[model samples]
Target: MGVVSATARSDRYPKQDRSRATRQKLLEAAVACLAEHGWTGSTVTVVAERAGVSRGAAQHHFPTREDLFTAAVEYVAEQRSSALRELPAQDRRSVVAALVDLYTGPLFRAALHLWVAASHEEQLHARVTELEARVGRETHRIAVELLRADESVPGVRETVQGFLDMARGLGLANVLTDDRARRERVVEQWAGLLDGALGD
Candidate 1:
């Protein structure tokens, strides 16, 4: 009985690992497709092909297009949050730059696509709205931590939120053109403003 039990456990692990790996691949591929092609172009079949998994396998994991994309965005958001948490103590300027970089990445691009689609798609609206709210709260909390801001200090919370909003605006601008030079100037100016607004 013990030997049979051990054999069964060993057999299960490989299958479980493969399933996890497949799901991860699908999520990543979905994000890439969304970022590169936007919502109208990113379909389940396309994502499955990009992931190098069969459509049947992708469907088994996600069941629907909405499920795949929402999960993909959520998964990448968690990963970005983890990366943010892992940053070592840095100067406020560095922290500001790091936060801004978050909005300029592939994850943000993919999430923006999802947001645009959700605006017109009833089936996706509620799920995307909830996900964005959760992600927004987490990002704000992380920004506060990274900036060492005391929200107890009046205006500090709003200041942090304003910075995030500005970063998002910069991201939107970059979608049309390479705004690197202008963004650098803006980042420097914002870091100085943040230092004053969220003082030591």
Candidate 2:
């Protein structure tokens, strides 16, 4: 090949980068729409508009509404999982508090909308079930690593699982009413209990 100009090389990669950027934008917009307005409001057209992209482009990336939303759910989960991996070092109490905040925040709200909608939509139910399982496993992995807790010990695994289940229940409660004070109280108590049982 003849001398490849710098401009040509740069131009070649931008098309792919732009495509990825657009897809990411759509995913993020979908999450925001779901959290703010629920699944009924998160139409592909609405998500595209929120992302500042054309409906055609959104459809090109995600041919079906299910495809778009399922991808969006996975996208948010993966983003949160990645962030969890990079969390700065903190004491057990701080980590537990942070984890509680995460479970009750925007990402959890977005997922709540999807879960409720999925219960009524047969096609969506299957995808959300699978996605939720995968995200759950990843979250568990991150928690275990962060805590360095020995799951092999008797009751340790059950306790951790129970804590996560409790957090999720609290998160669901937070959607309909103000459960912040109760959540804080429970989280602090749980943190202390966990430290007593598992701390170095």
Question: lDDT tens string, model 2, 1-200?
Answer: 44577778788899999999999999999888989999988899999999999999999999998899889888988987788789888788887777677678778999999989999999899999999999888877777777777888888777777777877888998998889988888898999898888757
> Candidate 1 vs. truth: CA RMSD?
0.9
Residue pairs with backbone atoms closer than 3 Å in model 2 (clashes)? none
User: What is the C-alpha lDDT profile of model 1 across 1-200, one tens digit per residue?
Assistant: 69999999999999999999999999999999999999999999999999999999999999999999999999999999999999999999999999999998889999999999999999999999999999999999999999999999989989999999999999988887888899999999989988998989
Give each prediction's root-mean-square deviation over alpha carbons.
0.9, 1.8
- Model 2 stretches astray by more than 4 angstroms: 1-8
Candidate 2 — number of clashing residue pairs?
0
Candidate 2, overall lDDT? 0.86
